[model samples]
Target: MRKVVFHKLCAELRSRALLEETFHVTIEEQVAMFIHVVGHNWSNRPIAFEFMRSGETVSRYFNLVLDALCILARDLVCIKSIDTHQQITSSHGRFHPYFQGCIGALDGTHIPACVPMHMQDRFRGRKKFPSQNVLAAVDFDLRFLYVLAGWEGSAHDSYVLQDALSRTNGLKIPEGKYFLADAGYAARPGVLPPYRGTRYHLKEYKGTREPENPKELFNLRHSSLRTTIERAFGALKNRFRIFKCQPFFPLKTQVKIVMACCALHNWIIEDGPNVYVYDDAAWYEALPRSVRNHTDMHQENLAWAKKRDDTAKMMWEDKVGQTVP
Candidate 1:
């Protein structure tokens, strides 16, 4: 982190009165300690030894910073309306008319977690280690709009998404605006997914294998756009090393750490340097493909399928007209 960014954060915390100079530890040291904990996943003992303080003191101030960051989350992480008209009118070619009403992309990522022996089964999914499934939505700019963490690793992506939709104050979608999701999620009123059994991942569309049909074209574009969330996840995990490994904190504190990291991620995106580069090819090759389940398809699901078909047809016709020779 830059010194200017660090001082800026200190100023903000001081303005909120969240941090003040202790007798021995100054506010800057407290903020630095918090950053070290989140950035490096340093345990209380190591942090205390480095700061010349006791483990108890380090733990107390660490929790205090965590609580403060959680409190600031509301202001930092938010969903703002994108200007559809300007986006379509701009020079950005592929996303113009097709993604006009699209607000952002949504996806689920597994964050490593440490759980008790009795509860490890529920937390351990396909991965050998225990983890938590986190659902997050990010806009084109790579800023997180909404995040739901703490779901057990074994929980399906659709299940976590369903929980998100069921909450009274959960993920909100405007009437016409929709978010692009991967095949792991059902294409519904507020969520639009690519056509099933089609080429969706970016890796599938490398080189001469371009879209052969309208559905394929839509899938290609959808994969390109929806991969934004994966890049967001990569950037988040890359910035905060705590996500790379399972911290020794309890399950509940681990959840809070996820949320706190998200809040800080957004803060860096907004104020920090433009260091987060979205490497699509590398990211696509690294992540495991999400398993798609088509069971229990309902009436609304059918309607969403029809909606995708109609949108694909419209995009194809538009492309044909533009390429007329």
Candidate 2:
């Protein structure tokens, strides 16, 4: 942030004639407006005081920055390359290529907010609060890829992705590449869900409400793949602290704040470890030791478990169904 602010934005903008988000404001003005929005509780009063600008001007410039950020985010937050194999590299480290075939770890989080009395019915979430449902995807790098805001809190995770996959052309992920999700979603060609069982962590289990079979193995791999999303969500909530609390804004504004936080997360990581005081210890301490991985819960059949897992499942699925090359 310091480098971007002090060096890139400040120094560079002053040196050149800058393009702007809107004709009503300059790029520098938009930056200031953006900083004020994220810095304050995004309240118009505070923004007016901080910038010594009228609320109207602040609102104008704030939207300009947000619009630009939205466009940038739409382009940048997408899966660029997907490699399915894990490659061992001697110098840099072991390369986890399996993540390449995967787009992101996806989960739906509740973003609370004030709602109109009449509209509140639709906005009521699983927690029974007035809010918006935010569906986010995080890559292995912990960078946010997709953020779907503006859904009513009552919406389910499966419904959220269904809209994204079916409606949005830009998000047209190839047929074979899959994303990791929790059991909130059902399994299909391009999405995977975790196993439902008394004993899990393996790629497959025979103890579901449904019949036990090789297909059940997909659930186990689903659990393993979906862990990344849980960790990502945990870290995000811990960092913001506000996500856990009810948002005071109206449902519309709440969506804006959620997207802004995602952008901020990218900004913080880009600034590196020192720019933000990331509570790595707090996060680890919060994790259930038994739930860290499937093995952490004491899986007795380790070797056999690995075998029944997805060595051929992904291959067979590709042979029979669609496979991304």
Candidate 3:
């Protein structure tokens, strides 16, 4: 984090009464300790040695800062807006009119978890070690809008998303606005997923084997847009060492760490310099948006399917029209 952003964060914490200076340790030191621990994935002992504080004091301050940051997450870790984003508008040839209503992109990533031996089974997924399925929504600028951490790694991404929607203050999609999701999620009104069993993912569309049909074209574009969430995850795991290493904190703290890390990521993106510059070339072809409707599940599925088909048809026709003499 930049010095100015760090000072502002400290000030915000003080103003909000989330954290305060103590007789021995200042807020700056406390926040620095927390950042060092997460950024380096250092244990309490190493943190204590580095900060010249006792292990107990280091642990206490770490938890305090973690809690404070999590409290701050409620505001910092939210969608920028429901309106059409400038990223699409500015790049008119890319995702502008096609994905106009796309509020953002969402996906789930597994973060290392520290769980009891008895509970490891539930937490362990395809990963050899136990992990948690963390769901997050990120805008075009690579800033997180919503984040739901602590689900068991074994849990399906779709299940985690459903749980998020079920919460009283969970993931929300404004009417007529939607988020791009991967094929792992079922396509609904406000969550647009690419066509299953179709040619998706940019790697597949490489070389001479380009999209052969409307569904393939749609899937290709969907993969291109939805890759934003993946890039966000990559940058996050790369920045925060806690996500890369095995967490030694309690299971609950591990979960909070996920949230805290996401909040910090957004903070760095907004306040700090452009560390992770948005890749224009990578996001050349993009995604789709959706509407908020609670009609019958079958009907809603068909509606969204038709929506995808229509968008794909339009994209394909444009491609063909441009090629014609």
On TM-score, the candidate that comes out on top is 3
Tens-place lDDT digits, model 1, residues 125-210: 98878999999988877888788899999999999998887775567666667789998888787799898898888889889997
Off by over 4 Å in 3: 272-295
- Give the better candidate number (1 or 2) by lDDT: 1
Off by over 4 Å in 2: 5-29, 39-42, 84-100, 200-225, 235-253, 267-325
Can you rank all candidates by TM-score, best first?
3, 1, 2
Better of 1 and 3 by lDDT: 3
Residue pairs in candidate 2 whose N, alpha carbon or C atoms collide under 3 angstroms: 82-100, 83-100, 195-219, 203-217, 203-220, 203-221, 204-217
Worst lDDT 10-window in candidate 3: 277-286
Q: What is the lDDT of residue 275 in candidate 1?
A: 31
Query: How many backbone clashes can be found in candidate 2?
Result: 7
Candidate 2 lDDT, 126-230, residue by residue in tens: 776777787887766677767888888898888887676655332344444566777676655455555445334543344555323444534444455566667
- lDDT (Cα, tens digit) per residue for candidate 3, span 1-325: 7799998888888877999898999999999999999998777888888889998999898999999999888777765456787877775644657777997899999888888899999999989989899999999889998899989999999999989987767876766788999888887778999888888879887889977787887787778788889999999999999789678878888889888998899888889432332223232212223444556667977888788888888888877787799
Q: For model 2, where is the 10-residue window of minimal lDDT?
A: 86-95
